[model samples]
Target: MSKGVITVTDAEFETEVLTTDLPVLVYFWASWCGPCRLMSPLINLAATKYSDRLKVVKMEIDPNPLTVKQYQVEGVPALRLIKDNALLASSEGVIGKDKLLSFLDEHLNSN
Candidate 1:
């Protein structure tokens, strides 16, 4: 497991993300989604690449419908950056690792 990445469940979302002191990048996914599988490694890389500044976690939407609906996650492979209990950024679909890192860098750098 990456130092900054963890597999979070609905039960842990509140404490692991919304209440945490560090900025969080949440990967919203589902087992049956193809793109979710494709994006997993990149998410892990982001976890490592930005380990110092960010806490990255993957939340499976299927088993965690409450989180899914609360976040209004209509699709898989969705990434949301939250801090101070507010959403700071988000992206959808499977993007290249570079682009994904750029997205996170922009927000992480600015914050």
Candidate 2:
């Protein structure tokens, strides 16, 4: 629940995710989505744990129509991994904290 994860939008996508030096984990969610609410806390914790190597960001798909279309995001609680302005991986649905941490560890270390 610290400010480790950044909230991103269409306006900030380029500067925040595309230009970031570190790998980016974009958590696409919506306020009304129950799974989003359930997954957010774990995502926040993962953000704090991996703050050094990865930058976690949240985007409300409803608010970021351009980004959603650009990224082809089709569902809530989706995780998109990006590096150097290119999307590396994307996963949908809610996952446990351990799985998320492992995912971060695998991708952040591989890049």
Candidate 3:
């Protein structure tokens, strides 16, 4: 677990994500996934940088099968932006910090 990242489980997915008032950024990751591990620091940065506006959450695919299946996520290190229980946009794989911030800025600005 990284700093500022909320580790969410399958049991708490709905309450933690769908019911949130702020825009939720869900990081779908796993312990065995290399890309997920690589993206951890970036995730922490986003969690702290956007702490006031966004809610950062991390969901492990193995234990959280239902949420993953429901979202139809294809791979690890998937970053999903959600609001009002709707899937707004997503990014896959290990993206650079600059691009990640750009993506976050765009979404935050639009929303």
Candidate 4:
């Protein structure tokens, strides 16, 4: 866990994410993925920028197979916006900073 971002595991997923009061941005990534590494800073920036309104978390796919399977994550660097235990939006791959922020704003603004 770093600043606004919390690293979650299979055991903690339900309690930390599904049960949270705010909308959660679940960042699904793998250590070996280049894009995952490249998107790290952007993810951190999002966590800090949206700290007041969003709960950001990172889950490594290799160590958290149960959650990965549950989320149906087919690739590293995947993002899932969840609120009230429901999936609101999903994006895979490196979508850059502008797109990432807009993605959040688009869905979050409505709710």
Candidate 5:
């Protein structure tokens, strides 16, 4: 697990993400996915940057089938912004640092 990110499983998803007071950025990924590997550092940076306002978690899709299916995550390197137990936004593929931060800010700033 990264310094600022928490690794979550299907069993812990509800408690770790949905019930938390702050917004959560769920990073859905797979070990074998090349792009997922590329996004790891960016996710970690986002976690540190938004430490006060958001909770960042990583979920490995293979083992976390329940959450992956529930979230309708069709691919690896997926991101879901969850706040107040609801899905605020979702993105898939490898996104750059600036775009990732902007994506988070867009939703986080409004609420």
Candidate 6:
């Protein structure tokens, strides 16, 4: 419902994330993952800062096994950057806001 950080479901992954006109940040996280919790706020900040250029979506890996399998996610707190229905890059572990922004910036400008 929020313009910034969106909560995505497996049913909506194809239409909402892969087919989106804007670049998408798909954060794969679990409620029990400590690093995922830590990175959430920074992700929210990014969602707010890059609202126009990006869409940040969070998927709970525990509940979304199909997406986890589709993305080949080996661990929690992973992020997949998708644009134009293709995966550009993925990040594992918790990264700072600057690093996250820099990563997004690199990919967003690649096209």
lDDT of 4 by residue, 11-45 (tens): 99999999989999999999889999999899999
Instruction: Give the clashing pairs for model 2.
Output: none
- TM-scores for the candidates: 0.94, 0.94, 0.94, 0.96, 0.96, 0.94
**Candidate 2 weakest ten by summed lDDT:** 1-10
Cα lDDT of model 1 by residue, 17-87, tens digit: 99988899999998899988899989888888888888999898888889888888878899989999999
lDDT of each: 0.89, 0.88, 0.90, 0.93, 0.93, 0.89
The worst-scoring run of ten residues by lDDT in candidate 3 lies at 1-10
RMSD each, Å: 1.5, 1.9, 2.3, 1.7, 2.0, 1.5
- Give me the runs in candidate 4 sitting further than 4 Å from their true place: 1-3
Q: Please give the distance, in angstroms, between residue 38's alpha carbon in candidate 4 and its true position after superposition.
A: 0.8
- Tens digit per residue, CA lDDT, model 6, 1-111: 346688888998998898878888999999999999899998899888888788999999988899999999998799999988889999999898889889988998886
Off by over 4 Å in 5: 1-3
Q: Which of 3 and 6 is the better model by TM-score?
A: 3
| Candidate 1 error regions (>4 Å) | 1-4
Residue 68's C-alpha lDDT in candidate 3?
92
| Candidate 2 Cα deviation (angstroms), residue 42 | 1.0
Q: Cα lDDT of model 1 overall?
A: 0.89
